[model samples]
Each structure stands twice: as C-alpha cells, then as structure tokens.
Target: MMRFVQGKTALLVSAIMTAMLLTACDGDDGQMGSKGDSGVDGASGNNGLSALVSVTPLAVGHAQCAFGGQQIDTGLDTNSNGVLEMSEVDSNQTQTICNVTQNTLAVDLVGRYQSGVYGLSAAEIVDYHPLSQSAFVVNAQSGKVDVLDLSTLTQTAVQDEAGYSLNNIAKKTELNISVDTGLTLLGAVNSVSVSGNLLAAAVERGDALGNATQGNGIVAFYRLSESALPVYLSFVEVGALPDNVTFSPDGSVLLVAGEGEPNSAYDVDPEGSVALIAIEGGVPATTATVIDFKDFNIGGTRNSELNPLIKINGPGASVAQDLEPEYISVSADSQFAYVSLQENNAIAVIDIATATVKRIIALGLKDFGLDANKIDASDKDDAINLQAYEGVYGMYQPDTIASYRWNNTDFIVTANEGDARDYDGFSEEARAEDLNLDPNHPQFAAAQDKTQLGRLKVTTSMGDENNDGLMDKIVAYGGRSFSIWTAEGQQVFDSGSDFERITAALLAMNFNNNNDENKGDSRSDDKGPEPEALAIGQIGSHTYAFIGLERTGGFMIYDITNPFAVSFVDYVRNRNFDADFAIDTDTGEVEGDASLAGDLGPEGMKFIASQYSPTGLPLLLIGNEVSGTTVVYQLRLQ
Candidate 1:
C-alpha cells in the first residue's frame, strides 16, 4: 500500500506540472491531461487544487464564472480548472464576465452642434441621410440647409475609468438655396424630407421679408452628392406659404401643406390647400395637383358656416381661408395624408390617389372640469396647483401630427400645441380677466375675481358656446398633452395633464417656462408644457414615442406599444436657463446664444434605429429652433 501511494503521488505531481505548462502556453492546442481519482476522505490533494477539475469552455465571452465560492471577473480563464488562480487575476484584461447583463441602455448626451449664426434658428427640421451618415438641418431664419457629417464622431476611452467619452464635434456645410436659385427665399425652410437619393425641401416664398406672397411657395428637389452635399435638381411652384413637406415611404409621391395664411390686415387671404407631386423615375413632376377645401363645405357655403365647429373670427374671411394647414403627415401605406388645421382645430384627411378631400374630423374642445384633466390655468399661483374647474374648455389644436401602424392598425398621434390668430392688425387673443362670465354659473364668482383670470391668457375666437353671438365663456388654446386618434379621426387615448404633471415633478421649479430654460411659470398662462414635436421608433421589443415640449424644452419618452396603457420611460432635457437673451425689442426678435445654453425649442425630431445607426446604436436627433442647435443622442440598451 505504501508503494502504491508513492507511485500515485508521483503521477499526480507530474500531471499537475503538465497542466500548469499547458495553461502557460498561449494557444489551446495542448490537450488536458486525464483526471486522477480523488484521495481518501474526499479531500483535494497537493495544496487543495482539484486535479480532476477541467473547464468545459476555456474561453468565456461576456459570461460569468465562479470558483471556490468566489466570482471570477477576468475574460480569460487561464487555468484549465474552472477556479480562478491567484496569478491569473489581472485587472488589465479588456473583457469581463459580469453576472448581470451589462448592455442596459445608457442615455447619454453624446453630441451637440451649434449653428454659430446667432438667432438664425438653424434647426427647424432635421432628416438623416443614411447613405452618407449625415444629417440635413433647415436653418429657418437663414434660409439655408446645413449638412452635418456624423462618421467623424469618435469615442475616446476615459483615463482610469471603465467607460468611454464621446467627443462633441461640429462639422457642417451650409447650403443656401437662394445662392443656387437666385430667388429670394423667405419665411425659412419649413420642412425637409429625404429618400434614397432625392431630398425634398419646402421653402415659402414671399414678396418681401415677413410677408408670405400669395400663391408663391415652391418645393425644391435636390440630389444628394457623393460628397455629402445636396445638389439642386429643380423646383416646382406649389401654393402660398408651404408649411410642411414629406415624401412617401416608397418615394413615389411628395406632399406639401400650404398654410395660405391671411395678411395681417384680414384681407387678401388665399385658400388653404395641399399639393401632391408625383415622382416618376426619380424626378418630380413639373406641376402639382392642388387640393383645396372648396368642395367639402359643411353647409354648402364658403363662409364660416361651412364648418360650424371651426371658429373663424380672427383674420380669415371664409372657412377655406381660415383652415390653415400647419403640418402634413403621410400614411404608412402612402395612400393617405393627414393635415393638421391648427387654428381651425380640425384634422382633414385627404386621399392621395385622387387628390381630393376625404373627410374633415373636427377635434372638439376638451373639458377641463373632469378630474382626470386638471390644469393650473393661473400663472399667479405660486406653485403648480392643478385644479378642476367647471366652465374651462380647451381646444385640441394639434400642431404637429404623425401616423404609424401598430399591430397592423393605423393610428395618428398629435402634439396639441395650439395657436391663436394673434397678428399686428387683427388680434384674437385676450386676457381672461377682460371676458365676462355668466353670473348664474357657480364658477362666475371665481372668474370675476382678478387674481387667476387676470393672469390667464385665452383665445377670444372660440367662446360663445350658445351661438348667441355673445362671449358666454372662456376657451383656451392647446390641450397641453398628446392624443392618439384612429386613422378615421376617433380619439383612442389622450395624455391629459400628464405632460404638465410629469414636467412639474421632473423639473420642479422650472416647469412651464419658455425655451430659455429658466425656472418660472410664465408659460403656464398661455400653454402648459406645450407639446410641439413628436417622433416614433421601435427599439428592441418596445415602441417609443419621443414628445418634445416647445415651452418646457425637454423630451418625454413613452412606451406606446400598448396605446391603451401607455407607460412613461424617461424624461431628458439639456438646457442652460441662465443664458442671456439677445432680443431686438423694436423687431420683437430674439437671437439665440448657444454658448450660454443647451438645445432649446425642439421643433423637429428624428429617431434612427440601431440597424441604420452610424454608431451601431439607436440614435435620437433633435433640432432646436430657439437655440439654433442640433443634438445627437445614443441609446444603449441593456
């Protein structure tokens, strides 16, 4: 027995030395030695290192490992045994096998690009050029399109840290459309849409600055160059004041929303219309088919009686003139176009194939008296006191609209950023304090008091619910939340006061303020956290809607997969409220200073999925008009 034990001990020592040598070698060509039987009493012989243990997988990629009741974090399991050897523990290893999934989404501020041209409001509309890995931003005030190259962005490793830092670089090329066309472009570049090689831009033309010429708007088609610049191809005349333009999914058609706003003097109002241009063989047709609202008069008349729900009191002479198409959203199938009639507080559905009005859906007023829909109408209140009232009403005047298909059903989402016809010559906005309330009503006592009503701003055009031609109640602009409607214009879901409530909770003292990023309730009297822009994208197994607040200046992300039970994901804002405002008091124009603030007034947003993202991660691009800035964010999913 003594002789047998000595021989077994010698064999075990030789086997251990051979295993050590094999682990010392770089490659896995060395086969693991055969395991010997355990010693008596089940104890590991030779310094407690188990000789029979062998790692099933020598190389572990992004996986966890344990040895001796301790966690092994190193990427390389140097020893053939699964246990971590003391000498094999190296902190310099690049990979780590974490127990938990390390891919959790890290919402980080990756890049911010400034326009440098102060007050130009450089970012109104942004579209990504997938082939070039670039972004096209419309400089609204400068009448120029800026192209930004995103491929040059690099991530640098932080010293003595586990994560990396991205460099905020701004390299852009400004393409002035006026330089190529020789036509004086006015009212900024309202919208931009991109297809494979075609880039469409809608530029409102005017006889002079600030005066939109009647029936003079144009849609310019440009071919993207190999050098990442837009080469002007040709332009076609559309209607007056083309506010928004978009391309079909298959690039077969182009739709334009011609606002046709009336002059300040309430005279010379052109009919609001939409233009459809067919794209044949990568070229837009010379002329567009103009679709107007003359044929679909509700009462068979062209006056305000055409649509009883539309209150045309400000400057518009007729129903057709009052229906200003603020934004255009094309259906997923490219067969329908939904136009948002902002001031009219209605949505017009148009058949793209026939170029005719299908039906007009009036988005009726929202009752603020309900408990689910409370609002802080008074800016005089020190804090955000959302209370239900009996007589207050709000118009669902959506400014930006988007259509998407969920579970094979088509739905339209609107950002209810209301608008009033507040012009120099003809103004329709008045303080709530100036309006008279019904004395018999219970809220009349509170309305007569000057504290809250004096500070509240309401539109005078939409009141007089009895149709007696007398202002009986007060109606305010903007619903202050987003709404989901069916393709046929039936309300499916509404965010109610979630926008204001969530913003108040997240921003605290800085809720309901303007784009300057200050902490004040100044904007509460007008529009509370006015939701202006919306973009939707599917990331992994969830669909998200990115809502941008034009007043509060932040993003409200929601998981809209189940429209009935939508859940909030996150709220992010990048702004500097302490920035000084450069204002021209006489002209009533404010110049943006990017150095003093982050992005402001997110008027346009675009979501890029990971498959098409240049950084191999999902991205969200935001165009801030007030700050004339564009920011790119990377979404890291766990």
Candidate 2:
C-alpha cells in the first residue's frame, strides 16, 4: 500500500522542536550506580519503543493513522518521523494539532493472495464463508477448490540480496475434484456457489478424449466444515456443459446453466437447458427438473419475438441447439431465475415453482449511430477514438448477469462481454471493408464507403437485408458497457461511453491495453474491456455494483442505488501490465516465473458486508484467471 502524509510543514516543524525539548527534560533521572560489574547488563532498557509514531491529515478533522497493520487514531508525530513516540500516544484523545489538507477518500490495497504457479495459471471463481472466515477459490485448470483460512492472513515485508518485497501469506488447503472422478470428468470446474452450509460446483463432464458428453454434467455438493474446509457430500447429474451454478436466496434450490455448446467440428450439438434441484434438509432431490428450450426453437413461429437480427441457423445445428446458457441470477422473491443466453443474445426466465421456461427476453441490437454509443471499432486504429457512424449495430450479448431491486421494482444488470460462434470447422466473421455493400441502401451509396463501414469487424450471420443474399447492414459484437433492464426485457439504462471515458481518465498511461500490457488500441476493435462478471453488494445506505473486466484486468465500482443516475466510485487494477514477459531464448516462447504485479482476467468475485466481515469492514474477493490468483480487498469509507 502507498502511504502519504499531508499537513502544514510549519506546524510539523514546530511540533518536532517541542517534542525534542520534552524528550530531553521530561524523563526522571535514575540513581547513579557507583560500582557495577563490568559484565553486568544494567536494566534491560525500556522495552523498545512503547508506540510507533505516524502523522496523517485529519480525515474530517480527526486524526487517523495506521500502525503495525492496524488503523489507529493518534496525535501529531512530534518527531516528524511518521511514527508515534511513547510520549505522544493517546488513543482516547482526539488530535487537534494537524490541519486537514486533503478531502478525497482513498482505497488501500491491504491484502493479496496467490493461487497456482507464480507465472502459470490458477484461480477463476471465489466464494466466501463469513461464518468460517474462509474463502473458497476455484482452480479451473487443476479442477480443485482451494480453501484459504482468512484468519491466518498476515502482511510481511522481506528483504533479500535482490531487493525488498511485500507479501501476503495465508494458510491454504486444496480439494481436488478429479481425484475421485478420474477421466470420466474431462472438463475443468466452471463455477461455484455457496449458501449456508452447502457449496455447489458445476463441473462439465466429458469423455476420455475430451469430447463433450451428450447432455451430461455434474453438480458436486459439499458441506462446509468447522475446520475451515469442505467435506464432499454427494453429486448430482445434470445437463451438458454446465457453465454456471447458483443457489436460491433461501438455499432450498440449486440452479445450473447448461450451455450445451457444440464441438469444433460443428457436429453432435446438444440442446441448451436449465436444471433445478430441490434440496430437502440439506440433501438433493432424487431427480432434477431439466427445463429445455426445444419448444422455443429459433425457427418456430412462436419464437419470432427473438431478435430478427439473430442468425437462425448455426453450422450443422438448429436454433434450439444454439441457445447456450451462460450465467444465472435468481429473483429476490425466489420465484424466478434469469439466465443469459449469450450466443443467442437473449435472456431466459425460468419459473422455479413450475420448473419451466416462462419467457425469453430478447436483448436487441445497440445502435451505434448516436454519439453516446460511439466506439473505436478497429484494432488497426493507432489511437482510441469515440465517433458515431451510420448503419452499425452491436449485439448486447451479455456474459454475466445479476439482479437487484429499487422502489419495489426488479431489475437485471448485464455485463455485455460479447461472444462469437467460432469453431475449427465453421466460423462466422467478416471485416466490413471486405464485404460488398448494398447499393440501394441510403447509407452506403457506393461500394467503397470507407467512412461508414471500412474498419468494422462484423459477423456475417446477421444484418442481411433486401432479400438479395447481400450484406447491407453491419452487426458487431459486444456493447462495451454494463446495462440495466426491466424484468419484462425493456432497456432501462446503459452505461454507454462511460466505461471507456472513465477508464481513460483513470488509467491514462495504459488505456485500452490488453492484459499483456501491450500499449495502444490493440483491444479497441475487439470486445473493448470485455465486462464479463458482475457482483452487487449493499454498503452503508447505498447499493454498489462491481463490474469485472476480463481483458483489461480489473474491476470498476459504481454507486447504483439509483439505477437511472449511477455514479462512478472507483477503478482498481492489480496486474503488472508493464512487467517483462519471460521468454525462452531458443524457442522464443514466454518461459518461467512471471511477475504477480496484479490480478488479471477476473472471472468471478464476491462481496461481503461489514456485518458478516471478519475485519469489521466490507470486503471484496476476486478470482483472476490468467494470473491464477485470488485477492481480498478491504473496503473503507474515506
């Protein structure tokens, strides 16, 4: 953590002089010892320093300082040494000596924990058990959940011949899921959720050759133990390619999102569905209710309410097989579950009581013609530019979604991190500059209209107008922002250009850079920050939303108490984008231990309120995928 001292220099100098005078004359002189043995050690000197001195500008006219990792309120540092002296220690008295110099509240990086190999890969999703004061981290590649004891966490500084480094140490234990299942379960752990004493993890099972099993997935259940560990309880079989798992508000049900994604060959695709497993007295029901979307096929007339811009047919697949469920969020009343159909650009509402699909909310295209919706649409661009153009549309294909309530109304928030249906056998991508434009369309009168449609990369699956089998309009991927929608699927609010504008303002040195720390607009043409995961928590009297950026490697905080007028609170990144990549000289490939400058590719996060927090302060836990690390941040009101 970075520390700063703010106050009047003149006042500080005077205080130091006064402290020196007091130190010289205030101590009582001991009786002179005339004859002490040469080897005798006098009195064991006063037990070191009674107190460490530090001075900080009063926060709201009250002294605040941190000593020995604990925040304390002490009087002025009369010695001007940023440490409290024994004479200056007075915890009960308010310090009125220093004047307030700064008004901005700041976030301090109090703790950080590492998971996998330093430079390799490790963590993805994390869930915290407030009662046990422990955190569960999903190690996706290793197929294990590492349980970390938060009480053992300590901050230490080590100095070696090389240099001085600060480290956060904690005790950890791992529970490997593959040890029991073996090759039968070929995929990595995708997501995890915890409620009460139960923890649920979604594991995508497949064959020994790594081919996805036909509608086969596993939900591993575990019981949280008082020993700060999880004991395996049982497992339940569900649909194929289960990407996300969640628990109902009351913990009476477990919801799984079966993505059912196809193979690279574009063959043998399974239909997407949702599974609801009822829990009775901490035990799963004998049979799970699988809610499939075959009835709501894209080609069916009843499903025409879906975005007409969506391509009805994928490679070697039908509409029903293409709606892949990505993530899920339950209603506050536990009556409905909202699932994001990422690839289809729609949201599926499932009735928990009936265990059936109630409705599919289509998230229509985002218009880029307006100034607020402008984007830097080309990776080839040298600099970041936000400008509007005609005939450009983007799909709000959200990856992670959450739910909140305000004024008794329910709302769904989404991270529009766009995805494409690209496989080894079939890919649907095209550059706008390479496609032939429709002549009759008013926007593009000529074939070479560079201003409107030159550098944009669009999907060829949609935007075909005039029934001439020609591409008249361009459809891009991702909205590059977070959005709020009504339960009925109407758009309520969109962050629009705020993400880019705010990020640029905060991270001016590395704006629009990738996780590798490559500078310039390398990712602007792509998903642009790729807002992948979202978690909301209530702090004080306000509700805040934490949006994690997948590519840019950090999270943004927003005060969303009023959805219509959300305000940006802060932006934090823990990754070392500027660190040098270790490379093998012979093969020219990156090698060996990498620097843990910060967290990268945050896939999952959890927020703990102060009431349940071990530190008596709000906390945010993040699981970063690329860096394979989990970091715990203590939130303080400045």
TM-scores of all predicted structures: 0.78, 0.78
Candidate 2 global CA lDDT score = 0.71
- Model 2 is weakest, by summed lDDT over 10 consecutive residues, at 60-69
lDDT of all predictions, in order shown?
0.72, 0.71
- Tell me the number of clashing residue pairs for each predicted model: 5, 11
Off by over 4 Å in 1: 1-106, 154-167, 185-187, 208-210, 213-215, 226-228, 297-307, 314-316, 517-519, 578-594
Instruction: State the lDDT at 436 in candidate 1.
Output: 62
On TM-score, the leading prediction is: 1
RMSD of 2: 16.9
lDDT of 2 by residue, 1-638 (tens): 22334454455466546645544343343555577524434453322222233544332101132111123344555555666665677665423342222212244455566653432336788888777888888877567777877765432212221111224637467777766544365467888888888888888887445675554888888888666467877778888888899999988899999999887787768878899999988787766789887765656655765666444557767667888999999999899999999888889899999997888888988987787787766555455566675677788999999999999888999999888888887777766766666766444642244433465667888877767787777788888889999899999888786666656544553556665444545577677788887899887777888899887777877778888877556676765555654423233234443443456678898887877776677878887776666777667666
* Candidate 2 accuracy as TM-score: 0.78
